[model samples]
Target chain A: MNASEEYEIMIGNHAAAYACKGAKVQVVAAYPITPQSPVVEKISYFIESGELNARMVRVESEQSALVACVAASATGVRTYTATSSHGLMLMYEILCWAAGNRLPIVMNIATRAVGAPWSVWTDHQDAFTVRDTGWLQMFCEDNQEIYDTNLQAFRIAEDPCVYVPTLVSYDGYILSHTFMPVRLEPQSRIDDFIPPLKHHLNLGDMNVVKGVCPVTTPHVVKREEGTAPGYYEFRYSLQRAMEHSIEKVVEVHDLFAEKFGRSYGNGIYKAYKMEDADIVIFAVGSVASESRLVIDKLRAKGIKIGLISLKLFRPFPAKHLREVFKDIKTVVVFDRDVGYGYEGILFTELKSALYQLKNRPFIKGYIVGLGGRDVKADDLINGVLRTIELEKKNEYVEQTEFIGLKLDELDFLKKGGKVENGR
Target chain B: MTEEKDYQKILASVQKPVEGEAGKTGSWSTIKPKINLDKCIVAKMEKNVCHFCWLYCPEPIITRTIPPRILYDYCKGCGICVEVCPHKAIEMVEESEL
Candidate 1:
């Protein structure tokens, strides 16, 4: 309840809500979903208690929730929503509308494992599913970041130069439900930092006469004559927005730190003991926080290893990583979500980002922590050791080594072959 | 009289563009829809009534008057009006057949 610069223990969902409240959002449209329910619940409380002056819309489904935000955002009002797992998946259709219409709708996804057999726990799969959906995706390390990222997300989303919908994500259950000390920024300062959201295609404007979010009419950019813009132009513009927002994300992160005295790697990626190190571990979210202790433990054992935690995933900081990887000899990329048929999503992105750069590290991909599996120091140490061992033998490292995976747990490897889903 | 026009720069109209890039779809027609005047609802049998074809036309090309006329120039004839017509009044015929 302390609106000033005061530290208090709060769960990640509440911290996100506190940041949402601080942003002075005009419309909050959300549905109840696991790990994401408390966020809207807290927002509803804020609305009921007169703490937040916004419409708290409780929609029956996540699709309607996002579509409502899209409509509200189109009319020049700041809109926010939070969802996770199946809710995010249910929102898949309208997500494109939010981005294609170029509405600066800020959302938070408590990253959760996608279900087939129904498990409600933390994993990157849900958020990773929407990487190509034209939104700036960022992952947070802890509850503090969940708050900070939400605050930055509005600025990043609403920037006239960007105008791309943004999603700030944190690990479900691990950070979403876990209580931790969060420093609340002063309301006055937050007001000063994030300016009011403005729609580029303001529905209130007299000039905007036609309906938008148009259907398919040849996806080519019609530069010839008698047309507004083509699908290709908008698509290219979204990409341009993403590329431009990289600098904006870093800039606003540093600006937030300057004002509130807190920033995580200036809002793109944070490094832990990266200086004077020959090897590094690159990962995202809670793994980054735990890697700090892992780095400490490894450095104690004379391993010149460091950790680089990726905060922004969408505008994937390719050039920054390329520059960093050029200086290292080896990097272990641990992704909590698998890219399924290929490799880990983050690992694939990291490897390709640094693939062409001269003197790039011998990057090794390790898939870990699927379905909220725990990643202890031993799991991380073993992954690192495997990477170093691969480098020693001059062996071609496999694309993905499933960390902490017990083969015996597989249905096929079980004593009784129990076919699932009646297949 | 002396003004030179850049066709690419000039807008097709004064109003805002529609979803199909304000496409002048009037030229998309190859075969046009011909209404059977005898069986037409508004024109022949039921005057000032039953504009089902007009309501069901995918394109806003059918206007209900004394007889609902199909704006064949813009109508990419898909037989939607024929399918929806209450009196079997509308029919799609080849431009050459006309």
Candidate 2:
């Protein structure tokens, strides 16, 4: 441990706030939501106490919060905000706007389940809902990872090769409310790690009057004066930025490890005990962290199993997943959220990623812990055992099944032991 | 890396401040607003006085000066200046009449 490093017991929300403070974010625009409020609240306190010289703009709603961050980030300043399920839903329009404009605004998502049954619990639905919005998404396993990922998010988002906004998400109550010891590097080292943001567009400059995200033709418009790229070209460039960010993610992770002595795999996903395993358990966030215990238990029983905890979700990291899962025989995905009409979102996406493989593994997905339900190690073990049994019996396994559900007790739907769920 | 550097040079949609972003709306119209210097308030006063046509012009093509002139490049023939000119100095004249 470095002499300049300080270890303190803090919740994931406070860790995110300290990350924002350490990065010296210039503007914080946010509105309050459960599980995400403490992050912005602590940032506001930092601003109030003059520990961080930054502007705190408390807007009416999450939409305006992101909008203000977009405008502030366009001015070449590092900006931040926090939101949850409904709040993220409110900011969906501006989320695309931020990405389309290539603004490097960082936001922490305390991942919560979207409501219809009015659930205020931890889930992946909130993060998965806008997976195609073109933002770089990272999921954290614990408070320490929450802190490290948040700091790394700023550098990754503002990298010249990738001027895309970033979302650092941790499970709502699991990480946000739970306290853990996080090692924080000194302010000078942090400053050296993440310098002031030098964004592409600076709307704050008065000398240069500029128009941003204006409507353009579907194809390039050429005239006697000059040539202007069309909307398609702009979108292609954004996609390229997303693709190129994978390298920057690894580069920044290595640099951070060199300076702060903390690393998470190659910054895309972290693997545990995959050297000789034929079957791998795939999960994200707290569920993946919890599965480490399950791995230990299963390993003791002479099972050839491992765990692949995904850190980066967006841009899918298809290449890396494909590389890691090439020799594997089976992959069992545990999701805290379902894709509603389809199976688990990660399960479908992982299948899509491995579609091109010549000898693909048999993959099964199980939905577990929706709406803050307690995800027990026994349940995870049972899920893994069920998958292994299906493999041994040579039976076609179901695509998605709910884990730890009290289906027998429920009187709503019981027709021959099969409930007609989603598509 | 060189390829990446090349992509970084020309990013997504950001345009410098330019006039006629929608491209010279004057060409879209058959008529344009014409101002008579003889009756214009600013023109007659010979000093920077009331230029209602310049203030109310939606396209804001009218110049704020002595004998205020309408910039025909992007006028769009809106006739807002004609209705706004208190002294009846502005009129939307057809191109054939001009």
Candidate 3:
């Protein structure tokens, strides 16, 4: 379907493809990985069917796929790519290069579980691992937000003040596979919204002298006046850029709503049932959307509970969250994934963000629905109840709890197991 | 903070990948190549035509003079001229020795 059509029923991957097409991305180089493969497949279909005018490079590996996009973007072309967990891991090297070079490359990630035993389920572990790589990280909760955010990502990333690469991540099967209604904006409106990409380095002309992070560095000084900055200064610029990015994100989000009549809580977060509420549940991705149902159910039974869905993950939206949670008594964070040797990654980030505030709430972390396990409304309520019960005590509540786990079976293994060590 | 008597050369821009304009890259070479003109190829071009050393040098400073003189200012001492000399007319001496 053309971008002129507004409403249609499509899966999340197809919605992503529609956004890339509407943005008129010039180059798409992606490797196939499950859950995320459909996004690349749909884009390739658009290219092959003569509907979307773009070059689709089917690379051999994820590293090559991102490098190809980096190369195309170096010449000032808008580029796109998509990948799942292990595929995202494989691209770690070039991913850092793309962001470090400030290429404004837009990529979609179908967030999935990383493998040791190899399970293809939705999780936030993959995205959390690369949060510091200098790309704008956005977590979308539904198909419509996925479609809209992908469209808006081009404007936000290509903004001269914030020329950092942006990653749009949605849940693996729950959102990527499920059919949902999405509204596609008109092509002219999208073109009006996001203009042609302008390169900071302007490598389009060869005579200007260009190389991607040239070698032989440590004090091998170029007598030329514009030698590269010290590594520390280069990284410091990115940190400053990240600090300035939240303003651009809000501007884009507000402009998008003004043009098409939609709102996403000023592009940082969406708070539900927060009015006159004492406690709130915080989550990201599909879990955030799922919590809405639980919030509605709890509010009806005289429960002063609210829900806060994180729309942007990176640059962590600290100020916005600090303002929202100032009055709340407790915040129950469901991570759906764990950070080794610590609590949930999002939970850790939340506590750290809220630490400097005047009236900080008692925040609790729970690892739930890992590896695609069902996290129903009832399961979420149990976690919330545990937090409430712990609130009335003078004792310490555990920092992290793994919800819906078969602890008895694991306990049996711990109590009565043979210790065979190749003797 | 002690940079050899507090010398700091401030840069005007962040990394411009200057091509042939990066002042005299020959300072990058550790081994200075000394060409022996008695057996040089381009020096004996009147006797026979062989200038492989000039053709194979990766730097722009190598020229085809009577003895195919290597410009030490930009030679970078990369020994390619020594290795590519058909007549075995060039030898790489350590820069300290030179």
Chain A TM-scores in order: 0.93, 0.94, 0.93
Per residue, candidate 3 scores C-alpha lDDT tens digits across A50-72 of 98999998789999999999988
Q: Least accurate stretch of 10 residues (summed lDDT) in model 3 chain A?
A: A211-220
lDDT (Cα, tens digit) per residue for candidate 2, span A70-129: 888888889999999999999999999999888889999999999987988999999999
Candidate 2's C-alpha runs over 4 A off are A1-5, A209-214, A223-225, A411-423, B1-6, B16-98
The best-first sequence of candidates by lDDT reads: 2, 3, 1
Model 3 deviation from the true structure expressed as Cα RMSD, one decimal place: 7.3
Cα lDDT tens digits, model 3, B5-90, are 10112111223333345578878878898877778856655443676777788764666566666777777777887887777888
- In candidate 3, list every pair of residues with a backbone clash: A227-B15, A228-B15
lDDT score at residue A182, model 1, on the 0-100 scale: 94
Q: For candidate 1, lDDT tens digit of each residue in A262-375?
A: 878757789888888899999998777778889999999999999999999989899988877788999988888888888888888997888779787877888888888888
TM-score of each: 0.80, 0.85, 0.81
Q: Candidate 1's interface RMSD, please?
A: 9.3
**Is model 3 an incorrect, acceptable, medium or high docking prediction?**
incorrect
Name the top TM-score candidate: 2
DockQ order, best first, reads 2, 3, 1
List DockQ, one per candidate, in order.
0.09, 0.27, 0.09
At residue A109, candidate 1 shows an lDDT of 95
Winner on TM-score (1 vs 3): 3
